[model samples]
Target chain A: MSAQPTVTHKKRVACVLAQFDTAADVIHAAEKVRDAGYQSWDTHTPFPIHGMDKAMGLSDSRVGWIVLGGALTGLSVAFVMMWWMNGVDYPTVVGGKPPFTTPSMVPVLFELTVLFSSFAAVFGMLGLNKLPRHHHPVFESERFRKASDDKFFISVEAEDPKFNADKVRALFEGVHATFVEVLEVLEEEVEA
Target chain B: MAYYAPLAALDEAHLVAPGSTLAEVTEDIASVTERTAPRGWWIVFLGALSLLGIFGGTVGYLFYRGIGVWGNASPTYWAWDITNFVWWVGIGHAGTLISAVLFLFRQKWRTAINRFAEAMTIFAVICALIFPGLHVGRPWVLHWMFPLPNQMAIWPNFKSPLLWDLFAVGTYFTVSTMFWFVGLIPDLATLRDRSTNKWRQRIYGFLALGWRGSNRHWQNYERAYMILAALSTPLVLSVHSVVSFDFATSVIPGWHTTIFPPYFVAGAVFSGFAMVMTLLLITRTVFKLHRVVLMRHLELMNKIMLLTGTLVGYAYAMEFFIAWYSGNEYERYVFVNRAFGPYAWAYWTMVSCNVLSPQVFWFKKLRRNIPLMFVVSILINIGMWFERFVIIVTSLHRDFLPSAWGMFSPTVMDVTTYLGTMGVFFTLFLLFIRWLPAVAISEVKGTMPQADPHFHGHSERSHSEHDAHESAVGGDLVPEGAE
Candidate 1:
């Protein structure tokens, strides 16, 4: 009889990390990892650890563009409101200046634009990033409590195709990492 | 940078005896024995409460009587009342700016001062709101600023900056309160766990809202805080800008200007920083928090004052330049009047105090000299108030027609209102210091050297350094599941 037909599943992924002595060392390692054709690698640090952005091959944040859009919309809204309300709705000739003028509306318009744009920048970023909802996989480990206080970590998400628990563990060990552990995903308790 | 020091080693309490753990630091903060509240504190609290009572009594009287008792007469329709309003609002700006804008810039030193500064901002705004709210004779009709489907049938004039002020100040107060409460949550939890009395524990527990410091909670907390910080930074800028528009949108020669928004914002921050310095100096001495507050923090605040002061100075020069360059006769007269006219003493007082006094901050010794810095900060506050008085009263006292020219003087109520506001400000501040942890414990804890595993050396060295560069290589080696 022929051998039974075999099936393979390819959805899970794992990340391997090595310990470095400095932020510069981590960046250097990240660059090497990037060059080696890994697309789903990231690094975590206790603090900001400047220049890590370059190591990760990330682009400039789009937050500013979002702010600009918000500001412009805010500016336009302020200008339109002032112009329509004062010039058209309740026109008054104060200090002999023309009612349908730009200068009178400029201050309110400028203030409002800045106001709206900043609001948009903040709320937009939060919504886009899906933040503050408070769900993450890292809480399952007790040692993770130190994430903000001292420890640095690398998380290769499960969506990454290169993930394999045994293979990733071997890679991390080869790099002389101080520790390695498989992240276990538990079934969430049903609310019923 | 080589100058970087880990902040962890400094955590050892010089006040508390050695061999204390992290939990004990919380205990020291919540200690409420007879020894903790010295006799002097009772005297101070009583003094503050008396001033607050005077303030409350004056407001109550003003409400019962008419607004006519104050010195807001013709020609100078806005006298000490508006001047104090502007001054208090200006003083409030720096707290949120320091906490939120500096946070975004990753200025780590802000952790030491942000908590008290934010509290100052809230109290200052409360003082500010009183004057404008009661300025109109009908105090109950203050809600006219809002849109309502009522018998009055009055839709607020959207074009008016006064109406905009309602929205701007209200937004600022709401957002600042939210940001402040969000920050207080974790600290409240710490207080809850440490309280000896059951009532104190229950009250703090409710305020804490059941925070457990779980990873998920921390994650969410951080995200919400960053968003709030981002919100507050811009709100700070906008509130003052809207306030500036109250004058800028007008056609009065000195009041009208395109650059007023940025100019006012800079001046607000300048005065705000000075007021912060004034409060911190006294609070540090009273509470014996010199180590936590540090001379470095004072120096950093002085640097901010210098920077903002320069911007304000530039704004002063720009106002004159715009007047001359625009070739407008009235605008030129307003500029000339502010300098060489009847109120020139007030004008020059504004210049020397706001412009020149801050120059002393350039000297590191002067900046670190607590007593000298305290005096300069108080003088700056005085000068800033006079600056507003000169701007509001001088410009309006003599307008386009000399025939309408007049002088203004404050009645006793005006004087009392100003004093009462200070009383209210100090009362809240004193209560805050007594009841809560003045320093941000979580933020300070976050800056510890041992918190950075890359830190290698004596903990003392790391404790003093605000910025330390440790290797990120070790940071990345944290086990995936662990993080």
Candidate 2:
């Protein structure tokens, strides 16, 4: 089982996706799987499960850093744009005030900072999550579709070092999953 | 454990109705969109569409003619146009307050209403945007508001508050739309999964961006939501403040006051809440969402209206007191003239509607009375509009040069145009409710007792034992039943 197979196949087992009727069941299974040292596994639910982050052992998201970076960039851009436009590029004195007053520039500067930070926060989240994905192997399992509605699910990927189909099936059964399914990667999906 | 019981008891009052399962919540909320539109919806939509038609015609005629089409004159350049702009923008603020501010404060009641409020904010801003664009007269050259390179090489006057309004309103619309969309993602995914029709599934699936609701995705999503909420809280405050600057930065006596920022913000909240109440009342009745919207929610909103209304009334009095105390003849004249001058009818109407009407909520009976609250909300809406009208028209109609002062009156065009925006607002809003989950199903589910991992009677261990077991496991994952 440890040896690499040479034969080319159109499909391969990606993971065993189990469906649970309750969050506690899924969380319990996730803890068991984590204890068993499955690295490339994930749980899914309709909403964020409280303390699932610890169960899954995911670190804090990096989207905030992206937002901060975008905000600083925005501030810099605003300063440069205001300085270059009003002060250097085409200078004009209005209301007997200097061309570039800090008080007046603050609103635009603040608006731009928020604008950029928001964009960064949203797009960075999507990018980090690798979303807009048209297909995934888990979608092959009809039972897994309930992940977005009422059911709770856990999918342990084939890529995990300790992945053994027989053992994974036993583990899911031991945890009393309502349903368990094996997802298969299609030939076209691999080509795409 | 003894101390924790009270808190747990407090949370048991269902945010969602008791006996609601996750599947039921999804079905209940999503079914509204999946089903046929109600008769009431069609009636409202048709009325709004006709009004939108009137708005289109009025604007078209204005563009063909000139700014002279409206009642705007030499002295009263800012009349109904600016008034409507300020009023609509102010109404948009409550949505952000509910979604971002209340979320940050952990006010769970907001979940039922925030989605609708956010939708209203987006729609209201669209209506508000129409005013500035058209008010510029040349509407075609509205791009001049932006700092773009032109053949003339002229940059917009960045020092001007009008320029600030551009940035403020622009950023506001963008961030509000983004915040609303991001919050919609998970809900949209739920809708997608529930959808049986292939086309419906495909469309909702595409909009859902293939969301799987994976734990990792939810972790990132919650973090991003928190950051957006934090960003939006200040953004909401600043947008209205910048709008206040549009008036305050002016040398006009009534306009140039430091109190305008907070005063305007309070007034915005007051008006926005009233509008939310007005819409939600109709919505709950039509959709039969009483269980979700709840009497508690409506009463809470009324209380907010009472508080903010009082603040607005106080501001009205403060403006007068300050005007009198400052000893500035121009300032004092503007205040007195607003109350007792040519537009005094409008001013008094504002005072009665905004200040006097909401005071009825001081009685608990009145607060819970839906019909009474509905009427008061409508009155407040009308009153807030008059508040803007009084501020803009009265001050501009009587400037320093009494010789140049003129009494401004609206044209047929102005009246229709204003009414038309209402048409536009409702048309968009009607569509929103018909297609989307007006109450957030997923969010409300999160507020349920079942959502908690250690929820009593569901978990095998006692709450304290569960906590101890979690801590004992620490960074390491414990096997099932390890404790």
Candidate 3:
């Protein structure tokens, strides 16, 4: 009768995530979680929740800086390549146009700039988000899979400095989460 | 209250269908790909495959012989090859227009058709690239188009519009495929989660790139999508303009016109829309996707056809007027000969089909008539091919020296090759429909009223208040039990 050893071994509670039906509820829960001084938390939804950045206290994304960097690199590369190739290397004047004609060079310059910037935008976004990750503690919850479908969820991780399991569970309850769960990171999954 | 009634009703009508849920949208669109191919699909697939076989045979034979097997000769060296090249490339433009330009403009209706159009853009560009590849005859040396250093120390003419074409089309294909794939990620996730089969799940799961639809990911995705769309807008416009430069940069009278860029762009959009309409009409019927591809969508496309068709007509008229007004004898001669020369039949056919045929769309009844729209779409496709034929063949046939003039007629190879490419286009298109989500599921889901968190009771409230109210009433807090 010693509480049946509630578990045979110690279990790691990764995060306490709650499901909310509407975008507003998740936004509200997010605001409450933010106000509660939780640093490691996130909301998952089927689409981009408008103004959720403000709710989560996030600053503007760093993706634009990356894209701009790429664009400038592309422009420079095009300029140097065209200058070196046509102007210096194999300077054959055709149609009476100058070998290093700026006008003729614009199309390639513009095209390469766009190509590089686009590559940067896509890969940069993926890198910033840390995507292609097959496993997350949040995914351990069967109910959490609905995040990509009709449900919205806010997950406050155990890694948060202020994370106290009981307090976080109560916090979700206070926000009237329809379903609340504490995700566990299994030993095997962690090892794998 | 009375004043708000109509606005509310309009908003209600904009919902995909009254009372359609997010789950229903996902199920309806995904189920088409999940299910077995229907009888019509097999029929069309076989027909397209047969045509693809013809294409393969024609290409093999052409390779065995040479460029001499076709109708290309001195002065008219650029015949059906260049014509089909321009035609296919032009058809690809409409896809970019619908996806990038309309997205920037915030036309939500584009969500319904953008996926289909973008796929068309990719496929059309593939068919287009083939012509330029084969036209070199010695396909092995086609790499010479690139500015790579060679043993001969010969570099491609950087100033040549043909070189510009290589870069334009190469960039267009890469950017378009990236745009289409990025847009497909979320929808692929939906399909992956919904699939019951293990292999299907694994494949889609891999393509989804472990997307969990986290708000963080959505934020980055939305920003990336916006950036790509902005990038693609200029790219699309530049692609056709560069294609026009292919001719305009040359000294050929009909080809060397300042108005070619805008005229070519408009004609590209016109023909692209016509091709989209034809495909969509057949698609909606075959797949029973009328609810998704609505009559409203069809009518809107028809109107675009009408608008762009008029722009093209005006360009044709201006070309003639400018030729006459400028008193450039060569330009005037080209224009007059185009209308009343050896190819007068082809030229007038272009006029009637492109300019006159679209006028019927001014009447809403005709625009909405599915059969009439289909026929008109086909007619426009034919007209556009003829338009390219008129531009390339007519202009090249009788150049500055009438002594070098010759009437160009296609050999069986030319006809089969063109037909073979059509076979190639349709074959790929059919396969695409069978395998992929024809309509973008996640995007179309966003168009529904239920997509908004604060949307309730046919009205919207401030976010904070709505959140407070939703949390207070916790019973409705979970959506229909997670699927």
Candidate 4:
């Protein structure tokens, strides 16, 4: 039988950038986005945009799990090291204490666990989030520099399948988003 | 548009007398400009300097004459060296806890005390380095702890807790120093800006690393700070735990207990907090930071002291009970002798200072009262030092068989080393206060109720939806680079 071609389209999240004078504009836009049933939408501001997490329907991150996993890995290594040292490498009976008792192993084990977990938490967070090698595409916009001072902006990704620039600009207009414009992703940049 | 004018009532144009400039209203701040020191301050500084001089001389003498010159001998090999080591290391803990742990917990009040605490960490660690440096017979071969290819071609025993101490202390000092200085950058910039003349400006400006408070600069600074805090929290806890391993992993009857790690950490926090209170009580009075620092911070720290003190007491009881229950005569004897031996007075003082004195803090009135807490903190410090003494000396004095047991006492040199360390600690602390902004101004400003627009009853004022470029991650969403 002839194979049927599967229909799949790339997803895009159209972001309407805004320079709101007051935080209330940001909140109102967030509410409007939520009402429009945009599940993959988010709001951006200079400082923390209060109540925006609820507006966007986002959940807590799994960064804690990454830390916990790293910590456990560290603890296991510590246990193995202790067991090899006291019980195997140079076993010397002192103060009539057992060579391989768990109580004596507790301190080193606990320390290694914390050491590894915290290390993992930090590096893992940075790695998973893909940070520190600092170049970003958003720097292309000249007006974007004003985002630091008095300006507030909202960016919707063009990669979302539903993110039609025209549709988003229209949506932004409906919500009274002044200066709504397309954030073009060049074909070469997209391909790269 | 007057958008840049501060909204605070005190920041208004006419908030002061109509004719008075903003400069004149804050003239009290300006008056400290003269380069003359108060005689009292000079006396204290000179006294600290002289003690520091003696410390240098004592260390030099010990190096030339050997560790045998100190009081460490049979039955008390660790006496003052180990005791002071533990005490100094314990004193270093509060700064990290105040800066990192409190920051993570979102306690904004830590800003007032964090800088001094951090400087305390660095100096206390420097003081701590002296003991172990002199503990081993050949102080010249101290670099043997580092994994270097030397004439003897020997590597340090990683299994040995002493080597672990080398690693732990070195790691701790490096990380803590980095954390402290990274936090000081913005504050250093503030100091640079405030400096009137060329010399101070040049010095502070160089130290400030060209920080300009740009949003991009603050973004990067915060990222680095968050990373450091995350790194240091575990490093601080682990370093002390590893330090406890110097004893816990040993076979010295009383010292060979599993409870030592948590016990040591709790004791470290207890002593560290006490030192903070001591410094803050004096500094707040001297520097007129009373209104800024406030009573809430002191009360919070006292509550912490009470909590840790209780934990320390519980650990002590558990150790005794475990000793008796283990059916080991040597272990049982070690605990019994600590309470009734020749140094029973020291032991009881430890109990009363660490256990009983902190009990007063259970009352909110006592905790909030500065003078009372200051006294309690000093007693707690005395008690904590004695605790380390009891741990190191009593356990070593009567270990294993009776024939090897002997009493030990600190010589005059031993006392001088400790006195010298106090000098070093205070001198560093004074310099830190004079040079750096003692508070994290940006973090503090961020926490002000005014920073939250919602607090000003203008939640609806933010609704001016003007389209602008933004990302979900907020203002500066630096996109991921290609692999």
Candidate 5:
């Protein structure tokens, strides 16, 4: 599919993967990998493993703060929109009520706040994950597909300063990983 | 062992059947989509499609004949259509309750049913929206329901409860759908991984967002899911309260009341759980998903129905008490008329179905009895529809002036239109079953005893400490469904 051959014809290694049969093994393996000092690495599994974050020495997500920001935006926007439309522009009169009233405005305020918070929650999570990242080298390994099924995996990317194919293999073997493999992909495929 | 249940009871409780592996959970759920369509699915789908056809035809005729074909007349202007709107909206609440409320409460068993309920929520909201959209009298001007710029620069009255209904229902549907889709992403990725061919891979892959299940992704995904759940908890309660506000804000004798919000909220949850129970009983049986959807889950759901149904019964009695206690002749008359006057049959039917039928659930054996629960579930829904009918029509049809008093009855068009919404609901539900994982497979896997990394290491006795630690994390940990 490539129209032009790159300067180097060799496929590039993306990451080194270690597979485990269960969540416990993968989590303990992650702790060992974390202690060994790898930066660009992650555990892959069908579902989130409890305590895995502490095991891997990762921090809490910023999605909460983003959600709070969204909530404030929704709150202010709802108030301003309602105030501008009913209070200032039209001066609408219904059932002898005032054109603008806080009590009357509370329902819309609540709804919009929730609506915006949800938007921020979904999108913030997606953005932080850098998702829709349709191509990655780890997917090239056939055994990696089980990451979403019965298996657990930890991958240390080529970008990690400590990354070494043989060293990663030795580390994974030390942790009793059931399988270990290196992923390689065409250079141009992941260029984007 | 990772669960909080008493160790004595743990021996008997298996959330996902014993010995089922993670792969099997995925296989069990995804197989419903991958396998050939069952004969029952075909029959139900065709029936639903025909109802949709009726819905389209009746709606067309309504447009051509201009809503007059229905038996909506002077005093009963809000009959049938409005009742259908409220009933469908109420049916959707069970989905949010199961997905969001149950999630926040750490109800691990919800994993078996949350996805199914969430899909129903989205579709029920759609069915509910159909009424307001068409009944706006001029569908083209429906944009006026929102704050938008136009040549005639008027805005929807912010003071009106109807406008709030617009906002509340709109926000409810959007958030609920977002919540459902977020939960689906990981499961969709599983389907993507399991795809045997290019088409399935492409379609499921697109929906899956190319999820690789990286821990970095899960950290934020879990947080987002939690936030959505928290946000939805209040939003679900508020949506129905605002729906009740439509009646409560009015000066009409039966409509004006202070107790409407909580009363309506309880009733919404009540009817919603009944709908979920009704549909779930059928879905599990048809799809052979008894392994994931255990009898214990059904019993738990029945218990919820019993709770909410009794709450609704309390609200009904409170309404009568308040009417008599208020010393307001009009209010007292409305209550008496509802019970002993022209629409007494409808009122009594509602009481019998909603209040009496669910009383059977108080018995443990009856609660778990498949046939009996099924019958009760269907009865609760029928009663809920009557509840709205009584509230809206009965209140309107017999207002203060006996001179203006008249009866409201459903014409064929009204019946057909309401039936068509059922078509819309079932058709969407059938398609959802045919394609999506009806169970939240990833969430269910999280609930499995094996999903907890600490499960195998700690003896059963020490697991309670881990369970406490899980709650102490502010429920950030996807709970090991060790219960």
Candidate 6:
């Protein structure tokens, strides 16, 4: 907390970016970045590079727990909704069965459980990833488009206390970065 | 023809074409969307559009003339509409089976086929829902299917299997659509990046939601995908089971059997694969995607069809055994009526197509035969439809009292509306492949050998630098000299 930088509305530095040619290169570069102790950085690739998670020193994802919570919520909602509708609210009998047939309610219960879990899975993933945040300073780099095509990249944010532009460039160069550059935060978009 | 090699034969089989690169995968799939519509695409589009028009016209007229236009009369109340509903819903299962089930099973081959099959599932489900909507006669009051508080104040029966089906199919549709869209996000970003024009960039970019392929995102994305797959596996199985319950819960001898759940599921898998193979074969050729959609993938799907088809055959035989062994006269009568009664022709067609036709896959050569498999695939679809017809119509038409027994003959409207759904299916499917990457591009790339950071192809020893990195990085990756 003590390392928090002073606010400067006119600050121009967005991030330092590095590009690599292969999955292996990206993985090795990610490992170097991890060893260098840059907290705010990510490796980008056309597809998930298999070993990059370990290389980047990431912990297990929290998505499973979020999904579990979602499933439980769904199960609860289904139970209450069915119980109130069938037993408490509008009671009726059909096919020689009593109202609030627990056995028959199983399908809807399972459906809602899965439904809410899936919602949690998708939106939980997006929220965790801070996605649907369409405006990001990283997109300003022309070379970054290749991150979704045939190339791999690493971007260390300027917000990181360890992120000195020249030092980041030197560290990337020490590894096998094919390219390295700094991106500036445009003035009007800083509020976002 | 070179016989399709099993994946165990390391010399021949590869996940993709032998030497395809990452650039090539992106280029191959993305170009399909970017390229101008081919002549064959236009032909199919026009044909499917006309079919869609027929669907629209028929539904409009049906809404005007009411449900009396169809052949739903006394005794045989549920006919082609219900039969098509089950058939189309059955066809929808292969998508989830491929995408969610195979994914959980770690079947790498599903990558090339899952997206294509999943789109098929959505379109098929839409087609299936049309039957029930129109079958109610009065379409305007369809909201009564839900438990809504209105003037009548009658809540839908929670115990009814019909209501259970609404929840099942509805959840199945919503979850799978979300699953499909979630999967599409990364691929959409690729299209956005590759776009040559403003509109393509804007649309694809908006859909992509600014996916930058950050490793932080992929970790969660992968976990979320896994959870969805886990959820969908049971959801897929339960969907067909609940659908079977629509009949299984009934006392209509043939429909009342305990085996209906597993039977319908097996039949769904069988018919769904047939539909997938039918569509995939055309898509593969038209799009020139033989490299990714390999003969090996087709052979694997054939093997699934063989297994499920055998299961369906067993269920058919077991139905008669149960009927006779129970010593219930009505059960025996229904079985006898199915095989030797007036609708015996349909019963035999079901047997020949659903049971006997798939047995040809016992031979490796037949399993790998493209033209033969295509024909069998179409036959199996027809057979599965007849299987539904046999269960619904035969069981209902012949009652305990001979006075109530009446035959079911589909009216022209029934026939046209049934075929019209096909038009709706293909029109949606064609537009899907045209606008979107029909293959899961990123997933395919992930499965390739080179996607692994540690994979150095056959020349692992040549990367001596990797030896140092391995020591430095604590060897958390795959072991040295991995294939």
DockQ, every prediction: 0.05, 0.49, 0.37, 0.05, 0.57, 0.48
Ten consecutive residues with minimal summed lDDT in candidate 2 chain B?
A: B1-10
Provide fnat values for all models in the order shown: 0.01, 0.72, 0.50, 0.04, 0.81, 0.75
- Candidate maximizing DockQ: 5
Q: Tell me the TM-score of candidate 4's A chain.
A: 0.73
lDDT of 4 by residue, B6-45 (tens): 3343243221122322122122222233245455556778
lDDT of 2 at B8: 59
Once superposed on the true structure, which residue ranges of model 5 sit more than 4 Å away at CA? A1-8, A189-192, B1-12, B457-483
- Candidate 2 structure quality by residue, lDDT tens digits, B193-227: 77889998998889999888888888889888999
Which runs in model 1 stand beyond 4 Å of their true positions? A1-192, B1-36, B453-483
Task: Give the chain B TM-score for each candidate.
Answer: 0.90, 0.93, 0.93, 0.87, 0.93, 0.94
Better model by TM-score: candidate 4 vs candidate 5: 5
Every candidate's lDDT: 0.68, 0.87, 0.85, 0.67, 0.88, 0.88
- Summarize candidate 5's per-residue lDDT along A4-70 as a digit string, tens digits: 5435456888899999876767887898898899999999988888777788889988999999999
Tens-digit per-residue lDDT, A1-192, candidate 1: 666655544322233433433333344455555555555656654334434455555565555666678878978877776666557765666556676677545545655665565566545544544543333454344444333333445545555666666655565554334455655554433232
Q: Write the per-residue lDDT of candidate 6 for residues A1-192, one digit (tens) a residue.
A: 356555445648889999987677788788888989999999898887766677888999999999999999999998998899888888888767789879989999999999999999999999999989788878989999889887889999988988899999999988778799899975543221
lDDT of 1 at B277: 94
Task: Show where candidate 3 strays beyond 4 Å.
Answer: A1-11, A188-192, B1-15, B457-483
In model 4, how large is the Cα lDDT of residue B137? 70
**Over 4 Å off, model 6:** A1-11, A189-192, B1-12, B457-483
Fnat value of model 4: 0.04
Which 10-residue span in candidate 4 chain A carries the lowest summed lDDT?
A: A183-192
Two-chain complex of model 1, DockQ on C-alpha atoms against the true structure: 0.05
Candidate 3 local lDDT, B52-135, one digit each (tens):
999999999999998788889887899998889999999999999999998997777788799999999999999999999999
